[model samples]
Target: MADGTRIVDLEAVPEDGSYRLTAEDPFGNETELILVRCDGEPGVRAWSNTCPHESQSLDVGDGAAIRDGAIVCPRHGSHFDACSGECDDGPAAGTTLPGVDLAVADGAVHLADDRYAFLHEGGIDDDEPGSTSHLSL
Candidate 1:
């Protein structure tokens, strides 16, 4: 967590499939990131936790829909690749979620890029509905 990048304890996330991460930094705003780990893959990935369609928090309800190896948005049933952030289905079909760059070291996940080191990327309201949050993409 050098440079004050928020760090998440990797061991705290489930290795099964997908999970939500509300990444926060004391000196920065909170960003909702989704933690993903697919079968046969050895590491964890963090994604912006917003459903690009409505800019709704992807983890707002019942967690991410993990089916057929993609993370489904709970709000509008949008699908995104667990590892690639590719929009596999739904409204934003051909688009990819803006990936939150991450690094793993000493059993933790840290921000890989300082540009998005803060949670206020693209001026998107991470918790609002009908927001143009995909500007980060």
Candidate 2:
């Protein structure tokens, strides 16, 4: 679980809610993120704590709470829509959170290999042999 490998813990996550996780990137960069369960279903949303506007962690204060189906950032009072990671308020309006591609299977969270590339807005070559992106832990 510490090596960016796919590890799922379904039982540890509750349905119809959100959970915060501290993870590391493949380069060992620690990131605080949130996972939300919108509605009674098992859908999950993953986004980094770093706000796109100022690169500040959005997990601070009461900003992590779910409001109108989005996660609010405590620092500058920005609201990140969970489903789309778009900002709904403050100076960063129309911006988006760094989205982390994740899925739920067998009752655990699984980080997608290509998610980081999307978050970074980088392109992947077709000749690549393996996934170019990975979570550190």
Q: Name the best candidate (by TM-score).
A: 1
lDDT of 1: 0.64
- Considering every candidate listed, which one attains the maximal lDDT? 1
* Per-candidate alpha-carbon RMSD to the true structure: 8.0, 10.5
User: Per-residue alpha-carbon lDDT of model 1 for 6-121, expressed as tens digits?
Assistant: 55677866554455545554666766677776553337777887777788776653356677778877767888887788886788788888876677777776677654554432
Candidate 2 lDDT tens digits, 1-137: 22233434655443433455555566755566656655434476677767788887554422356677777666677877777888768978988877777766666666664423222211122122223343355
lDDT of each: 0.64, 0.58
Residue 1: error of model 1 in Å? 9.5
- Please give the distance, in angstroms, between residue 101's alpha carbon in candidate 2 and its true position after superposition: 1.6
When summed lDDT is taken over every stretch of 10 residues in candidate 2, the lowest stretch is 117-126
Runs with alpha carbons beyond 4 Å of true place in candidate 1: 1-6, 16-19, 22-30, 39-42, 118-137
Clash pairs of candidate 1? Answer: none
Error of 1 at 83 (Å): 0.7
Q: Tell me which residue pairs clash in candidate 2.
A: 9-108, 10-107, 25-136
